[model samples]
Target: MYTSDPTPTSTLLDAAQTAARLPYPLLVSELALVLADPAVQVPPRLVQPLPGGARLLIMPALDANTAITKLITFTPANAARGLATIHGDVVVFDVATGQRKLILDGPTVTARRTAAVSLLAAQRLAPNTRGPLLIVGAGVQGKAHLDAFAEGLSIKEVVIASRSAASAHALVTHAQSLGLQARVVTNADEALAGCPLVVTCTPASGVVLSTLPRSDAFIAAVGAFTPQMVELGPELCRYVADNGTLVVDTVDAEHEAGDLLQAGLDVTRLASLADVIRADAFVVNGPVLFKSCGWAGWDLAAARTALAVLPH
Candidate 1:
């Protein structure tokens, strides 16, 4: 019997390219399939802190022959030092033989996959939008979303709102350097009213944005994975449930999201990514909201995709 060649390792740039070229609809399709497939199991938070406030998150996903295992570690100090806040590596292992095939840096993959998930949500939830997209956080995830959106959507203007005005302005300059129209906003409401699509990428105990544009607006809250953390208000959860369709990354994690549970948002009522994709069309009888805690299935989808593309 001949053993297969070793799995090939790739870089974050490889992941970013995969994210950029992969059609948005197809990513959502993969998400739907991954959600329905019983072989997939996403474990709860596996975070461990090392020296110097550095942290590690073990994210594992098993989808039949494809098993994507990731070890993510980072430090805010590292980020301040012009390094990565989230860095480490991902290993694609063949479950049949438990053979580690490929390894890639976690920071790039993390940022790319996170942005891909956001784009999937945006395509499905946000309507035919134009101009002034508001990004709540200016960190890695926030910047990744801005970069991905600039490539995928027709966003003419971008307004980044962060707790630090300087950081927000730096992101604006960075985005402009990338040749996209951008600015910084210190006021949340002003940014929301100016932009129809609002993406919250920060971690806050309370809502960062309230009183969104009452029109056909879309909000995608990508931060706040823990029960103690949330970026949107309890009212926003009600807004999505009452006015628009609420899409969750996983129904299982909904109970953990404080924004949803505190507001008494019915998890059963919310649709899954599969539900959204398999459906023929989206009927927005009301406002739409997507609360994503970043499911492991997404990492699986991206990791699997990466493994398939990388040479072994």
Candidate 2:
């Protein structure tokens, strides 16, 4: 347990070290615990606008044993600047003593935990579990999802689509290196019919994917968390809300899920991940959309996973 060891250590883990500790399977398991625990407290994240459309995110969460605050910056234009779009640290604390325990690379934690959350949703709800995973937007989040589905879902093939050819090809190479059959496509919609499992992780305010591959297709929309940004087409969002199972990572999506809100969806009427897990139910014969707006509880789960694997 996180509280068993009381001593505090200010060990600061870099991105590589952080990623080394939080593997997909372990992260996914921890996320389940976080989602189910009634004591876990995640207040609405505070967002501060920055110059040039970037923003600062402040997310804090705590349970009985541990507390964490993830401070990160979202700079949408950074990719073209050849720098990371997200940069910051996750500061962890021991709840019993009120002392700082550890620090982790914020982007690593976010990417890994977010992808793990999507993978967990897929395992429970997606009809196409093992597949030619179609990933749109070959950025950090895209790569992380590919790794997560490959390792957690045992995916054998991947098809990637992105505006940047270099980024897309690089992700495909990474997929092949992981022993998955990988290819690049000019457009994601063109590949949709063949691949049932799709992930859209771009920072677009417009639609990247507007259609479903099949009746039981699973789409994880991880990008465009703000009200002004959307990755899924409005019609597609409405179709899922009306006919299929639409799940959000948390209720925060009611205010933050751009695609759904743009489609004029009453997000409050949609089920959440916790609701789905608690009810132990899913849409049996229709499509599924997992809308992930950022939540602090996921960061707390990542902190727990890292703490568990850290050397005692």
Best by lDDT: 2
- What would the per-residue lDDT of candidate 1 be over residues 8-66, giving only the tens digit for each residue? 43344445554443444445456656756777777775868789756677888876776
| lDDT computed for candidate 1 | 0.70
The residue ranges of model 2 lying beyond 4 angstroms of the native Cα positions read none
Model 1 alpha-carbon drift over 4 Å, by segment: 1-39, 43-56, 73-85, 310-312
* Model 1, residue pairs in steric clash: 7-101, 243-286, 243-287, 244-287
TM-score of 2: 0.97
Give candidate 1's TM-score.
0.82
- Give the Å shift of residue 127 in candidate 2: 1.0
Candidates' RMSD to native:
4.2, 1.3
